[model samples]
Target: MRAAIPARIKLEITLSYLATGSSYRTLQRLFRVSRPAISKFVPEICDAIYETVKEYIKTYLMKPYSRVSLTKEQKVFNYRLYRARRIVENAFGILASRFRIFEKPMACLPETVDKIIKACCALHNWMRITSSNNYTPSGSLNEEDIDSGHIRQGSWRDEINKTLPSIGTVGSNHSSNLAREKKDRICRYFNGEGAVPWQE
Candidate 1:
């Protein structure tokens, strides 16, 4: 639909789908590409991004955030990097699930896929700012759950405290009714509703 846009821009659109796990059907029409082409693109891009970002993440960011170091600066840096990864990965997972595209082969694109990955990260930062609050553990469930599915209860608040966005939300400037509705859907997920707006 938005032709005349630079190829770089199209890449970003494609990356958004990958990071958020959006379906080919959602992107095929938008990109004017066949489903098979999209299927081919995502995986090719995944390696490229990991190659480009992994070094930056491990050295400048992750190394500094280490808590095991005796130096206070090192500890502080390590902690920060640790928290940042959590925030970033959580957002990626959110995108993947919301878009429903995290399966094999689909995540293989190249520059286009990288663009979508960045866009998903950017969108996560955006929503972090706009949400009414950083997600709170409202129910009896543990507030902090590792990917292993182990839920922690005692220091949940402490875990939240160590989180990157605990002090402030990320996006406070965007205004779109569609975005709001999408957020509502996400909130429902957080609430453990297990229902989709499309069903309603």
Candidate 2:
């Protein structure tokens, strides 16, 4: 008699296969499931996940886009929102790179394809949150990187120090000239003096 595969094992295998964009045949070999079964369940589970998260997507992303002529506060809000949305783009890139399966066209039906994509994103988020703290890049920064970091930090400090007005001469002409000079110095530094040579 054949033993039944556990539900947890099935879920994990389906998710791993979808998340990595591995072929159903590939999943069959790894999980010892029939290719048909793997193909059917991956989409089913994906649909379930998509259903669960659909509300969140509509609430957060269905709003109107911001125009460039907005007020300062609105502009800041839009800028921050744009930056935050970049995390989603980065997540997709990371998933595609890490899972070679996603690098190719997924051969499943369109509905199945959509479900599989959603499921993989969910699995990716879960894995990222649960991963250990020791997952930094493989090696320490090289000398050039270290030097570049120091140079940027030093330039920032110098610019800030030069721009700040002296405490004793709040309204004097000398202080105003000093402040203007400080601003000019900072502008020059950023424009060329403090910039990395390769940045051009």
Candidate 3:
């Protein structure tokens, strides 16, 4: 009987596949594993990693109101919200640029895809925390001009945009009362105590 592949090698293989989106054949050449074995184990490894680290991945679901006319407070709120959204986009842009896997859609089952994404997110967070200097060097991410308050696009944006399509804005007319209340509170805070000097 053949000896089993070690757990560490399996993990390395899975991570390599996720990071590069390389084909099994390519990975087989690189890792010396059979393509069929790689295909069978990659998804399982992703699922395991995702399950272990999914709790570290938190998502906030909030959308700014899509309207033309707005009050000053609402405008301030929107501006702040937009800035926050930009930060998030930049983060994903960095992730996509670093991990070529996200440059294109994964050709896999939806569940497997979800696992892959979760696993990648966990790994991204880990790298950011442990090796922030190497992971995100100066000027690699969007920067705000102190004097002009203008955003300087990051290099990651150029690389990511080459492969990914621009995201479209989705307008919605419906919002729950609780969500509205929360948005109002946040708006009030931004316009009031939380207001930044440059936001004026």
Which candidate number would show the highest TM-score if scored against the true structure? 3
Q: Which has the better TM-score: candidate 1, or candidate 3?
A: 3
Q: Return the TM-score for each candidate structure.
A: 0.35, 0.49, 0.85
Q: In candidate 3, what are the lDDT values of residues 1-200, reduced to their tens digit? A: 98998889999999898878787889999999998888788888988887776766777556686778988889888888988898888889888887788877777778878778888888777787779889888888899887788989888777764858665655764788988888988989998899888777
Residue 100, candidate 3: Cα error in Å is: 0.6
lDDT of 3: 0.83
- Those runs of model 2 whose alpha carbons end farther than 4 Å from true positions after fitting are 1-4, 47-59, 62-78, 99-101, 132-200
User: Root-mean-square deviation of each candidate, in angstroms?
Assistant: 18.0, 18.1, 2.6
Ranking by TM-score: 3, 2, 1
The residue-level lDDT of candidate 2 at 138 comes to 22
| Best model per lDDT | 3
Question: For model 3, how big is the CA root-mean-square deviation?
Answer: 2.6
Compared with the true structure, all predictions reach lDDT values of: 0.47, 0.54, 0.83
In terms of TM-score, how similar is model 3 to the real structure? Answer: 0.85
lDDT digits (tens) for residues 77-184 of candidate 1: 344445456655554444443343433444443665555455444444454445515422234123355445464443233333232333364587454676556544
